[model samples]
Target: MQFAGWLGMFAASTAVLAGCNGTDAADQSVAASQLAADECPSEGVALQVLGSGGPIAEAARAGTSYLLWIDGEPRLLIDAGAGSFLRFAEAGGNLATLDAILLTHLHADHAGDLAGILNSGGFEGRTDPLPVIGPDAAPRFPGTSEFLERLMSKEGGAFAYNGGYLDGTENKPLLRARDITTADGSGEASVLDISDDFSVTAHPVNHGVVPALGYVIEAGGKSVVITGDQSAASTLFAERLAATRPAILFAHHVINGEQGQPRGLHRTPSEIGELAGVMEPDQLVLTHNMNRSLSRIDDSRAAIGESYSGNISVAADLDCYPF
Candidate 1:
């Protein structure tokens, strides 16, 4: 089939020249399709990248967010970063059926669209309470509950008016924010949520002093671990996640080992490669790729590939993968 030009751009963009330190372009031609309209894989759990970019706004990519399609429904949304709602709209996901949202952190680029999502849902014809989960209050960060209160509470939340959706008659969103708190330094995996077919677990990951979390979404005999925007300064997190035997690791980091450079609490590629080597996941998808990683995709993949023999895929908005 002739590829659509936009898809060609997407496929081409994801490719890291194989000769560039042995990086592979193996999957580029499989399905070069528009991210906004791509269909989820029909079986197992399918994850679609809604926004693949990060903190800095970029015309070519939205912020960090993902949609999980289960039983053919886009029911779970992971992270609601800036402009994520637009991506969600373009992707044809039904807002009314969204089950829950898992926020890896409260960073503007990670959970910035929380209110936007709730506000938009106010018009999506949903009556059931929407669940929003995030980490507990840290020194400088507000927990999920506090954040929701400040956003939807009449007592000064910026969007208190949107809270009315929780009680409105039709086409309104009812929201419930759940905060997961594990004492800092505890590498224990805390259960954020559990269901018949799947469960979501979180553990602590180092991101400077911020109380951050890394999540594992387990379903259909498959596990996908998202390492939030964390550094691999410690081995506890990697060990905790490896125990899950993940099929995929959506690592949000890039390699910048130079000192005096602002690495912004993210891990370097070699660190990620080391972790992936131990986890031995079938695939290691490097995401939250910044300008550095974008310009040197092959280096990032090659650095990671040095230790991990698994397939390495650079994620782009709308790319879909099923477990």
Candidate 2:
């Protein structure tokens, strides 16, 4: 029921942005009453699912994105699909301290709705530049910088009008893109950000020709690994993830394959089991949900349980995991 209200509020944000009729005072009242701040924690780490669905839309879940909160503040964002921005707001997170934005790849399902952050007046209370990191270019996908240029470059870009936002106009900070080397399945991992508080590492994983990479984010002695649409069967994934020893594995997956579509891009439940069995994370969270996967969650859990004896949870949109 809370998630249902979130979907409505997310829609309300879009309507409010799209010139929907309403008085400012009334909107503020409604927002204040409905979207009040939650009792966020003061320490440890919390993994919040802003979105959890697959390429297609589903009523139960949004797209693929996760928010990493430290000391009750959202500091790192992984992917920003279409519906995630609104979900971010609905989840009681603001962009005030979002320092890093990581992308697994340039697939629309993973990085599509980044415009919400770069929009001139879309958000509030943030003036710091955001560092967007992802894998280098590959056969079909655009590199991180190229991808941002296509989205917000001043000239001849998809969101050209967002130049003002990208340039930090009106005292707002710009959004910067930084491409990191994705270790080519050689058991090597590339460090994207390393600070005294937290560190992030990227490891290359096969997603057909998508130039994909998985991420390991660690802070405060708690860690979580996110596989953004990675192939569970890839040897590189096994090698890279096995090294970090993540506390939780947020792996993408589907229950069954479809006809006339390719299965090389995603992992089957068995494949996920194989990887999870090898990593043996303290907990395993099956994300990137789809209709089939949601319907057969028990079957999927049973299948993965065959290889893994760890705690497993199917993530729903807005689900929170504190560690």
Candidate 3:
């Protein structure tokens, strides 16, 4: 059954890539090449790249966001960066069915679309409060409660009138923000069990000037890890994630060189390779790409391949992986 399902998905993907919608053939080719079988599971897990770009907008890439559909429903959304809202709608995902959101950090590139999603839900007549999970914010930014208060506060907030929907007279979706606590000196890393079949754990990583994080998601017996933004050598995070034997690792390529220099926040291509090697995942996916990294994809892959023998791929916008 799994093999048959795999064949069907492959065929469907091929059809989508064959100029079905009058899209540029080159664009379809790029999307098809990035799609991977390992990331897609036949049972019930589906991974969709809503926006695979970086903080800066690119004609080809849309900020940073990933959607995981379980049993054909939006189970989890990881990061809602700059343009992810449009991508989410274009993909036909029902925002009303979203179970929760996991944010890796407070970077504009990663969490910039939160307000947009809230506004969209209001327009769609959704009244239930949506749960948002992220690292603790008081010392950093603002915890979930304060984040919403500032956004929808009636007094000195951005969307003062937006609070009317949450009063129960009309259908207003609530934003339930939950803080994830990290270990002292280790940064806050905690596990969020959304359901019996789905659970996610976060680990703190280095993304200079901000409290950054990475997540390891376990669903349908498959484990997937996403490194939000970190310097290459995160011994603590790597050691914890290594135990999961993730099927796929969505690692960000931000930093380029050593740890403590000016670029102390992001990971270099070689560092990403080392992380993949330690985790030993079935596949390694590099994303959050910038112009410099995108130009050296081959070199990045080669660097990571030296330490990791698993499948390596560079993700693009709207790329789908079935798991």
Clashes of 2: 0
* TM-score leaderboard ranking: 1, 2, 3
Which portions of model 1 miss their true places by more than 4 Å? 1-38, 165-171, 182-187, 255-261
Q: What lDDT score is found at residue 207 in candidate 1?
A: 74
What's the TM for model 2?
Answer: 0.82
Residues 83-201 of candidate 1: C-alpha lDDT, one tens digit per residue: 88777776656667777888888888888887887777676677777777778888889998888878877667788777565444345665677777645535567886535667888
lDDT for each residue of candidate 3 in 164-226, tens digit (9 for 90 to 100): 533533577666677766432176567776767688887877665566678888887898888
**C-alpha lDDT of all candidate models, in order:** 0.72, 0.72, 0.71
> On residues 32-106, what C-alpha lDDT tens digit does candidate 2 reach at each position?
332322333557778887787888876546689888877777788888886787777766665667778888888
CA RMSD per model (angstroms): 6.3, 7.0, 5.5
Residue 209, model 3, lDDT: 52
Candidate 3 C-alpha error for residue 5, in Å: 19
